[model samples]
Target: MRGSFLYIFGGIMDYRKTVIDKLKEVDSIKDIDIESILEIPKDSSMGDFSFPCFRLASVFRKSPDAIANEIAAVIKTDLNIKKIEVVKGYLNFFINKSKMMEETFEKIFSLKERYGFSYIGEKKNVIVEFSSPNIAKPFHIGHLCSTVIGNSLANIYEALGYHVIKVNHLGDWGTQFGKLMVAYENWGDDEKLKEEPIKELLRIYVKFHDEAEENPSLEEQARYRFKLLEDGCEKETQLWEYFRTMSLKEFEKIYRRLNISFDSYAGEQFYSDKMPEVISLLEEKGLLVDSQNAKVVNLDDYDMPPCLIVKSDGASIYATRDIAAAIYRVRNYHFDKNLYIVGTPQALHFKQFFKVLELMGYPWSSDCRHIGFGLVKFKDKKLATRKGDVINLEEVLDESVARTLDIMKQSASEVDDYTKTSEIVGIGAIIFTFLKKTRERDLIFSWEDTLNFEGETGPYVQYSYSRAKSILRKANFNENTPYDCDYLKEEVEIDLLSKLSKFGEMILEAAKRDEPSVIARYAVNISQTFNSFYNANRVIVEDKNVMNARLNLVYAFSIVIKNALALLGIEVVEIM
Candidate 1:
């Protein structure tokens, strides 16, 4: 049974190809789209794989049940299958389990860290634009969803062999900077700025709003300053440049804690010069319409807000800059797909902008997508920066780390590098909390929910990985340890294998849908499955062969879980 596993495994590895090949043998229905008809049965007892015959009923001029019966009878002789059965209108296949275990485990151990990844996506490029925080502003809690989701999507794409360009489209330009500059001039203090850059900036921003309520003319002055900066005035440009630099330095600390990196920091400011070419293109294409002396793209037909190109005072808005940025990215990166990871509130904004691109007759406008995520609220109240009801991301991370340290001390835990481990678990908790939900749903971050150790939080998954690592260390598990795939017939072992087998499929789905929750939830499943397997089976058993096989299974699970966590932008600590 063990020796015959490989021959059977090789045949079933490409189940669709094998099934299609077998269907081709029946001369009466040779042109079947068998791939579309295949399905994974909800009940494992039904079969390993199944194909529905509803569509083929019309082609074969027979009932679905009859077509399934005929196809099942012809496919049974294939070496990969143990048996084929027609139940109702579906053809079900039962792949040999021993063979599956051997091929999967052996390949898993051989490939080790690179198990689920493949080169099927070679030569494709993806540009993931995410976590784009506004310059001179605090990295607030609201920015959490986009930051981690975008990073994880980039990782998922890369894992599937796409050359992913992680672009941080920083919010570094616009009329707002003029207000910031005016605020700094009125209340600028070098010592305060050096001590707390983003906080001081936010302080002045709030101050600007407060004062501007009484001093209505202040808005005009701010816009005038912005025009000066846009005109490349030495003093204004230098001030704006200083703000951008200082804000980035502060953001770097948070990015370091989250372990996220970006390939490009080309923000709205980077496209300042490029906007002219876009404006020229829009004008040349006769898409730019003047409404109330402001340049706009009339898109009432798309049921979206008009894409504002230029203000009445001749200043460019977000839509105008984005148009320039999108065209520049297509010309520069030649991306297979360009994603904008923004909030759901901006759905209309992106639609308007993308519609303008479509109106310009750019064929690749279809390749650009807006991956909109919902907002994060606190205490069931809406969070708005203008209201000053915001929690800084850096401060939240610091508090999480401190909380993690307290938990460790309270539990009297024994883990290496308390400082490093605390940061890992704390940041992991934050990242996991954000990624664990569907991007389109609103999340309220509760202290109890984020730090829960026994639940589906990041700590739970990290703890599982840590548990697997500890077991492997205790068993002195070796890569070359000889083991038999036959010894792993336990229900727990098969359950664990079932979870590990879906790693590749999970990644592909996550990338395709631009959703990180798929991988986040799947990681939790693998972790829970490993814990169940650990309790039911003993790895340091008396039987050396069974022990080796179980240990290898443990090692394989650890790799898959670690890979999953990494994709979610969560770090895995050896012990929690």
Candidate 2:
């Protein structure tokens, strides 16, 4: 709405609508809106915004390059447009430099720390189910992906004005608890159990599997004990609750270290009693079929396996519980979207459940999504929980923090609080390393690659934030003051401002796709860009106006980078 400039991303119905309206002069491009075809030029040389004319080419009966050139000629030079060009069938438009700096810096300086905030999802409620570690199990590196990714998504959705229900869907149900009880009864020690519950519990659970291999009858005993627990046998129920309590206490330590908070601790058990309602609904919808003495929803017509709802003995399985949970969540939270942060192995399972929901006549079933991430392998080998081959999450965190401390001691970056910054940097390094890749892509765990601070890692971004703060602190000017935007017209300065300008749009895109990697990549890029700008131009110059503008850029970079890092669940320290 500023009279002097056309704000690109932040402005509503401005330059984009203008371009779309002008492109309507070509009758072939009528149906396309700016959202559908607008893309940032992959190379900056291609210009600020690009519109590919390939789709319109077939209708226009001309080559895309020719159409692009015609469209470029059609768009007149306005106050907002510096020029338009045709680059290989893409209509790329460049904005006036002075206007870009003024709009970007002014918006960033005005928004300050709230640079990435948006109200796009104001009325929507999103339920994010993640970090569902099984009760009485040691927190392992296997659980890291879900915890960090899910928490980041929750933060991202909240940042975009969605009321996020951060649900820690603890895996506290199933026959596993029965097996844990059997192991605890046979090999458990009281004092050791109280001192190191999950470890001790895990030790005995592994022993049960080891012994069960020899004495196969122990497996039957485990199943029978599980049955009793399900039947609400008093002692079994009490033991299960005790294990859950002790395990939660241990898990809380890790959650606190990561600063993750959950709005709901409801696990599978919360929906245990509610499954019959789902089963009854399936029957009402004529979806329940008797297959091999089990209640199932026949999905063979859809080229999927039959979704078993109930066993021959009338016991429900995972799909049944999930069905009940979905119904419960919809009726309870009335969520616009339900996200399941799980491993890729369960893709079929989620698809099966979601299909069943559709068959049961839930119109909002399409809103459910499984944010499946690839498994984390140790030395390229899969880890087993029952076999005790997993790496304890606590151990990983402690070791990473210790390594961070050692690195800090060797470096000359004057960190004020070594202990606090080490924890932040170490945890951030691990999180950044995990998030740097696409969520759906499998990441190989390597200590050297993950902990490297020099590369595009969390520590690198954190260091950028710290460096920005340090630069601003040297001026003793934490307060924002209006400056002549014309002073920041250098190439690197404009590049930094352009990156800062796209921060909000990136957050919105990430939230829409449920991919935090977009913001993660953006954080690394902005950090690199700011570093380049710092190397090219000195911020502490003698010219007061130029110096203030540079300092504002530094402060803006620090705040935007910090905000992006926070969305990814990474914290920035004053120094590193």
Candidate 3:
């Protein structure tokens, strides 16, 4: 390929692209997409990159082995490939280790913190709507998935040069507020409500539901109060405003501890005024129909139930507000993509919502995506807010910090600030656990898995980074001096360099799949790889050339690992 593209970083070539470009010289396979069939060999003994010739057997009208032999003999070899081996039907290409090491190390040192960033998402705008916790309720563990996942996705997009808009999309409107109003009026204590707003509000919220079983008229009264709120009754509006303000003040404490922020706190209430405009647009397009005296969009043709926009009693539902909010975002931000990081239970709701937008002749509706994740379970039991069975997020954060501190004390590890460092590692542990797996799978929260420093957890990666820092400090490494790649000819060094070389490619792949776990898992693999290299050879050897090369390798690894964890919304501590 001649290394034609000088991507964001300097002199770092894509080896896979090099192999594919070389293969394109063959006339028979020139028309084929060689990139799709290229694979990284499982065993390093085979080769660095492999190209199977089985798919070309039909065109050549010969056996797979014969095709492989013919292609290997005639393929171009002017690139950084040391040798090519034809094993059975596979064409394995061994990379030139010295060139690979030099290129990777040079790129890392040149770019530093900007390593692995690209311009793939240049000039695009993305809106990430997540952590839409209900006001007047506890911020429990159930909200963790959307909050962290959405935040990490934002970070990933920004690394690729995308303009990201983070929206909290607070759940601040509905009949639930009516129930809260009734409960507060009858049983609320003003002093307690002021002391712990979320707790007192949650208590009253649960009581309203419990009392409605014996007295059914309470349900009717709740609905009437909601209608009054919708009608802008002076008393109800004042109460709603007071509760919303208190809830935001309480939610800020948890967000600050987690180091998460939002560009917009515009909740469902923000769209209340925009809903009528959406309804009018639907009517103009002949997409809204009357069903059971309620406004709905018929979707039987799409094999889904009708999407209800308004209740029979003339009240707007969630779908109404969501459609309005989406339209508002497109007009204001002109977003290229809008993503919803809600739970899997709301899958059907989004499907119906998107279909309605499509029917209304909006081409941008296709860019609106729903990123749903599985529920959070404790002891295999799902949490419910109305039942008062939930784990507060603040409690989890505080307890994790305390547990981390206890472990540090038992191990006799000394740090300047025990509490502050422990809090960083502790919260990082929880966030990493939530992101280390695919979002579709349910996550079970446990003390052992979260706090395990020896496992494939966040603390392990953080510890590895700390160890690298310690080594560099002991040796007093000088980055200004040039290092020789010739001395780094060990097998372990090659493997670590190969892994480090793929960071930029791995980042783009993660963005393509819309999965943050890709980066999380990469952090674990790279940490383990660096540890293996350290255990096999010493960085502080007698020879100046060998010591300098290994030190540079260690420095490159530290930089890459820190960048990977940052993409997952994780922070690394210098001491552990």
Q: Pick the candidate with the highest TM-score.
A: 3
**Candidate that scores best on lDDT:** 3
- Cα-based lDDT at residue 563, candidate 1: 87
Candidate 2 per-residue lDDT, tens place, 1-576, comes to 222223334542255566666666666566666457887778878877789888877777999999888767666867777789988898898777677667777777677777768766788999999999988887776578999999999999998788999998888888788788888899988799899998888889889999999998888888888888778899999999999999999999999999999999999888888877888899998999898889999998899999999987677689999999999999999999999999888999999999999988899899999998987765523222334466767767787799899999999988789999999999988888788889888888766766785788887888888889999889887665657778987888888887787787788778878898999999999999999999888999999999998898898888899899999999999898
lDDT score of residue 328 within candidate 3: 94
State the lDDT of candidate 3 residue by residue for 57-118, as single tens digits: 98878988898898898976655888899998999998877888888898888888878887
Q: Please, what are the lDDT tens digits per residue for candidate 1 over residues 528-552?
A: 8888888887889999889988988
Against the true structure, candidate 1 reaches a TM-score of 0.92
The C-alpha TM-scores of every prediction are: 0.92, 0.92, 0.96
For each candidate, what is the lDDT? Answer: 0.83, 0.84, 0.87
* Segments of candidate 3 deviating more than 4 angstroms: 1-6, 9-13, 380-387
The Cα error of candidate 3 at residue 414, in Å, is 3.1
Worst 10 residues of 1 by lDDT: 2-11
Error of 2 at 388 (Å): 3.9
